[model samples]
Target chain A: MRSTLLIAWTVLIEAIRRREVYAIVVISTLLIGAVATTRFFELQGLGKFYREIALQIMTIATNLTVIIIASRQLPREFESRTIYPLLAKPVSRLSFMLGKLIGVMAAGTFCFLLFMLVFLAGCQYLKIFVSPPLFAQFLFLQILGLLVVATLSFMLSLMTNLDAAITLGSLFYLLSSIFLSALSYLYQFSDTAVKFILRVMVFSVPQMSLFDLSEKVVHQEVWPPVPAFVIGQLTAYSLAFSSLFFLVAFLLFRRRPL
Target chain B: MNNSSAPLIEVRNLVVEYASRGGAMRAVNDVSFTVLPGECIGFIGPNGAGKSTTMKVLLGFMFPKSGSVKLFNREPGATEARRRLGYLPEVTLYYPFMKAKELLFLYGGLQGMTRTQLKVRIPKLLEEVGLAGRGDTLLKNFSKGMQQRVGIAQAIIADPELLILDELSSGLDPVGRHDLRDVMLELKKAGRTIFFSSHELSEVETLCDRVIMINKGRVVLESPVAELMKPLNLFEIDFEQDGQPQTRSVSGAEKFNATLAEIISSGGRVIGTRTATRSLEDYFIEIIRGHEGSGR
Candidate 1:
């Protein structure tokens, strides 16, 4: 566990010192700032629109940052030959990889925290009524979803090159909701074998849409916070898929000759 | 620490392969050797002769197709085995964002050293490696030679009982190489077992108690460095040519005598004569060429 933390600390240090996350936060703040300051032609649902746009921007910026950083971690280590001296020590490969996963998550959390601060500042300027419960759920679920994306990115990085891994991870996040919705609709009309395949696909990949609560946060006045049972199921769903992806990555990496 | 008198490293029938368009290409073919405890063994081989591949398998970074490799008679990369080991890779780049001290701390921490231990050792280790008072400098600003010094520092930070160094003098300037030699000699006196490969045969000759030379993924020669250096000798004739000094070297007394007589007869004043010995470099080139010639 200590080895894992040390390795994770290195990754976090790289993210912090590189100053790339700060750039993401700055860009997000600008987008949120522009939207917050706009008149929107004196629309009636201006608060909801602002909330919707700000949360979406934060989600996109944070998730993409997580995916990109996670995808590059292993490939960069191998390419730069940095893994040589690192693996030469008394550390195990499993610990090294776990450290990387946790580090990437830590970086994502740091990025998310910055985005959250900017987002809240935007809301404050607009005097919007934000429900604490729904906002908390939204934040927690988004991090859980980032873990899923991070693990998938790690697996893809091991199986393929860096760019392809990043592109695939981001594209999957963008299209997973549509893919799941389409699978559900197509299962009703498909033949037996196709339906079985669709069912397998449904369970094979994470249902990212299940982790999103942004819409609830945006319309908090219309609905109460999610119950504990749903949160439990979502947590289990994230852990299951993340484990699958992380297991594949570890298997590929354990015996690879660097 | 594997302190018993057993071999520090043992390998037998080790075969490693890589997948290519030409089917499975073998990089190491039935190579075998053993390194005894407290012995400084030099693993010398031509490029692509499987030195790094063998080291990777010992570190468990690579899996063998068929063979047994053991450090301390345990499975390679067992935690107990690794804890007693320190390795310097043939080529590596430290994290550019990390300072020298920070990098050492990370490596030392992985070796189970606490912060207090690192704090006491890092400054002195840096000075020993010739990088005094530069611990806080980021690695990005360091030259390749300076980075190699940092590599040396990190490798010895934990003071392991066994050290595996690949390309021991790579990327180092003359001063860096000298400092490393001094450090390695100290480790040798301290009874640390070392297995390392280097293209610099002179460094091997100076530091290695025994040497295992390989070519084309096969062991060509394995012997004590003393045994090899004993029979190999060279003689030199120092003379003046055009009011300037010159030296001519030859392998045998017959050739040395002839050259000396010729210089004197041609009105070149002979200043002195001395006997020297053949170097590990000469022996390495000769063996490799002979091996290739036999193959042809």
Candidate 2:
């Protein structure tokens, strides 16, 4: 565990030096500024409009940053031959994978929190009111969603090249967010064989939309009447799927001829 | 276990293959060797001769398709086995953003060293490798030779029992190579088991107790350096009057002595007489040429 954390810390330090993180931050700030100056803000319910836009930007920034970082972590190491020295140590392949996962999570969480601070500052400038509990729950769920995406990206990276991993990771995120719920409706009307395939596909991909509480937070819904229970379930779901992806990645990585 | 009694490294019939467009390509074929404690073995081979591939298997960076490899009587990837081993790769690629001290600390931490240990050891190692005050500089700014120095430092920071260095003298200037030779000699005195691969046969001849030569993914020769350096059935005798040097191809020591006496008695004034011995480079080339001729 200590070795894993040491690798994670090293990776986190390396990630912070990457220009991509700064680029994302700058783009998020610019987008927030553009949205604040929009003529739509002059209309009524300005707070909801601003919150919705700000949350969307945060979601996109966090998810994109996670996918890019997680997807390229292992591939870059292998391309540069840095993995040789690291794996040549006393660290196990499983620990190496876990350390990478933790590093991606840490970096993604930091970026999300930074973007959230920017969004909150933008809200303050626009005189938008955000309930603390709703904002906290939304932040928690956003991080959970990012974890799922990062884990999927890591797994894809181990199985394929960088471009393919990132492409498949983005596709997975988009499909899970937009069409995962619609799978239930499609399944009800489908034939038996098609239904089985649909069920398998749905089960294989994570239901990322479940962790997207942006709509609820924008409208201040805080679903299920018990935010703590929802948080627990989301945590469990993320851990379960992340573990599966990490296991598969470990198996592939151990067999890889570095 | 008694460290002196046990072989530090043992490889048995190791076979490693890779997939090619045509078919499976064997990188290492049925190679076996052992290194006892306090012994320095030099692994020499031409390009693509599986020297690096075999080192990778021992370092656990790659798995063998068949056969067994053990370090310190444990599996290669076992934590206990690796803890006692240190490796310097052929190309040491470190993260460019990290400073030399940070890189050493990272590797040291992975080896389970504490903060205090690293604080004392990092500077000492950097100094030992001739990079004393450059620890705060980022690796990207360092030259290739400087980076190689850092690679050596990191490899020895933990004072491992077994040091596996690939192409140890690569990218070093003449002075740097001389310093590395001194360091290696010091390590050998400290009872460290050193198994290094190199194209510098002179350095190997100077430092190693045994030489293992590989060609086309197979071990063509393995012998003690003394035995390989033994004189063959040829002699060269030079006279004091600067006459033409005479060369003799004799079958036995008695014939060589008789020829020497005959030349001296004839008032030839024998200045110097020596038997012809083959250097490691010549032997290596001859073995490789034979393998190529056999088309194996």
Candidate 3:
């Protein structure tokens, strides 16, 4: 595990050295600064307007980072055939894929933290006493969301070209998390067979809504510890998604002509 | 276990196919060959004649549709098999963003080498491939020939027992080709088996001990350079006969002199007499054309 993390770190350093990660960092920083300057406003009883904006911005940034970075890993390898030399070594395909996943996740996580820091600093500059716990929950949700996006993108990259993979992966993430949230209401009123199918679909796509503590964070409400059920489900979903992606990558890459 | 005489690389009835847009195309068909230690065998063929396909199968880039390839007694994709073999593809594509030194280090590290090991070996390889002073340059900026040299360096970095090079001389000028030929010879002298494919028949004729010619996914000929180029005894006699000037062929021991005399005796006056001269290149072309014309 330690060695895998070290390889991840090596990948990160290489990414940063090439200015790819650095470019995203710069862009995320600019977005944070831009969002923090929006005029003061209010949104119903749900949350403070600025805090809501902050959460949304961080989520979008996390999504962009994953889409942009993870999608590039395998496609670039395919184009350059660099994977040949790498695979020719003692490393397994799983290790290479996992290393790529880690590299992308680390980059996303780093950007998430940076955006949070900038957002909080902006709040402080405006004399808004943003509680530490509020920021913490926002970051937790952002990281989890980014994890899903990274895993999905990594998987899609194995089967499709870079741009299409990113687009389809981002769509899958958005639809699975947001659009699929409506299935519960349908299950509550639908016929027995339809309800069972809806339930299965809900269970299959990640219940990202459960992990989104952003609403609670923005409201400055007392935050509950992430439920073990939700955490377990998310973990399983992430693994299943990543495994599916890797399996496809393995099947496709094994037969790749190079 | 002292089977020192066993072939360094053994392939039996290897078959490889690819699903093309038109349909499934057989790239290699019942192709079987072996490389003895210290032998530099050249695989020569026209474009798309299964040269690269066979090499890819040997390197584990593509799995064979049928048959078996055993390198060092291990399957092609097995880690143990790869560790003992080196490969250079026709196109040497590297991570454009990485400098030469970093690229080498990353690949070496992937092979489970320590930093110290890479540091010790990279410089010598760099110098050998004429990239000694340009280690810090991004691979993207290097010219095609320079990149090919670096590609060769990486393949031989581990001093592999078997080196599979696909079109090694591509993009190299005559001088560069000569220099690389010398390097290959040096490696062969060190007891390494160099299995390379090339369309340049002359280079194959000059460097290879035995040459395998493939046409349309089939091996047409596999013979030693000396034997492939052995002079054919058929004589061509041109003379002006009763009708119009015609050519006649003679057989047996008298074929040569009889043809010569026939031309002179017919008052045709042996205008010209030529014996079949077969070079390796001509033989390669002839066989390829022969097979291709037969619609094989």
**Among these predicted structures, which one has the highest lDDT?**
1
Where model 1 places Cα greater than 4 Å from the true spot, the runs are A41-44, A191-193, B1-4, B231-270, B293-296
TM-score of chain A of 2: 0.92
Which tens-of-lDDT digit does each residue in A134-200 have in candidate 3? 4565566557666767767776787778989978877776676666857866777899999889878
**Candidate with best TM-score:** 1
DockQ per candidate: 0.71, 0.66, 0.34
Candidate order by decreasing DockQ: 1, 2, 3
What lDDT does the true structure give each of the candidates? 0.89, 0.86, 0.74
What CA root-mean-square deviation does each model show from the true structure? Answer: 3.2, 3.1, 5.5
Q: Which 10 residues in a row give candidate 3 chain B its minimum summed lDDT?
A: B1-10
Model 3, chain B only, scores a TM-score of 0.82
Candidate 2 lDDT tens digits, A149-229: 888898899889999999999888776656777888899899999999999988887888778777876777444333587
Question: How do the candidates rank by TM-score, highest first?
Answer: 1, 2, 3
Q: Where does candidate 2 chain B have its weakest 10-residue lDDT segment?
A: B240-249
Q: Is candidate 2 or candidate 3 better by TM-score?
A: 2
